[model samples]
Target: MRDHLPPGLPPDPFADDPSDPSAALDSIEPAQPLDAAERLAVEEDLADLAVYEALLARRGVRGLVVVCDDCQQDHYHDWDMLRANLLQLLVEGTVRPHEPAVDPSPDAYVTWEYCRGYADAMMNVVEDD
Candidate 1:
């Protein structure tokens, strides 16, 4: 059979396999590099994440709960996972899929806005002291 693979691309190992998992997936385009503003935004998020983790972790907060737009559901990400995802976006221009925390306690996670407000309040208290 004639090879239809693109130049420099390896032959598909699952070409003749009936159970090829990728056969069900549409081809995904390469992720675009972050623009200057996007890069800045991600950097700021990373900095804020560090502050949030430092302040909240000691208070028994596990992590932040984000509302996923694609799935329209709440996704709980621990501090480590959040940092890893942000770093991945900075380095690879894409975030690898991560499994949500298993049986996460909703009460232990706060929204990003809550974190920001908490941080701001804490900063004000520190300045006033």
Candidate 2:
């Protein structure tokens, strides 16, 4: 039976033992806990997200577009989708699956940095008045 498996793949020690107590343990993975700093960052992102949505949506902006580091591509997320993602991260401490907006127009979405700059400029204008 060992020869039937591909090279370097360990044969399951409990494959023949249906009642083995450790058999279930092999399939269970522990949930990773987030550190204090990571938790705080997620909270901050969620708060900033709400403000960004309100401020940008008023200027005919549909939503924010972010560049995926893993895939090296831009993903457009609608306002609700962004909220859900942030909330999920805040609550579950894990990143949900990526769900890019459907056929979003390039003109309607802006990068997070752009949104931050816009917010900063608006704040400065308000302070100057």
Candidate 3:
């Protein structure tokens, strides 16, 4: 048995474990930058969202006030809910179908119009191709 082993080697650290040892460590590269127009739109979106988040944090605004584009009414969503909605829209290119009633819970959400306006302002500033 001694002669069968190789030199300058160590036993497997997790030989008894089923998982890959390297799974505990991983590295990722930074995301690629957006193009000029894309960069501006993204920056604008981020800036507006940041402000909304800050408002939520500082003013204890509870939830943002947003106007719905589909139904022409206000839809209220809390931070978690609003985040979920934003992520959903980002993935799907459109918001969920339903429109919540106006005058939602005191801390539910803001109108979509505000989000659109904020995003639009950024887009508007960009030079047309």
lDDT to native, each model: 0.83, 0.73, 0.51
- Runs in model 1 lying further than 4 Å from the true structure: 1-27
**What is the number of residue pairs that collide in model 1?**
0
Q: Candidate 1 residues 70-92, lDDT tens each?
A: 99999988888788788778876
Can you give the lDDT of residue 70 in candidate 2?
91
What TM value does model 1 have? 0.79
What C-alpha lDDT does candidate 1 achieve relative to the native structure? 0.83
Q: Which runs of model 3 end up more than 4 angstroms from their true locations?
A: 1-43, 98-103, 106-129
Q: Model 3: per-residue lDDT, tens digit, 37-122?
A: 75466456545666666644455655566665667755665555455545444443433333344555655344446545654665
RMSD values, in order shown: 8.6, 12.7, 16.9
Of the candidates shown, which would achieve the greatest lDDT relative to the real structure? 1
Which of 1 and 3 is ahead in TM-score? 1
| lDDT for predicted candidate 3 compared with the true structure | 0.51
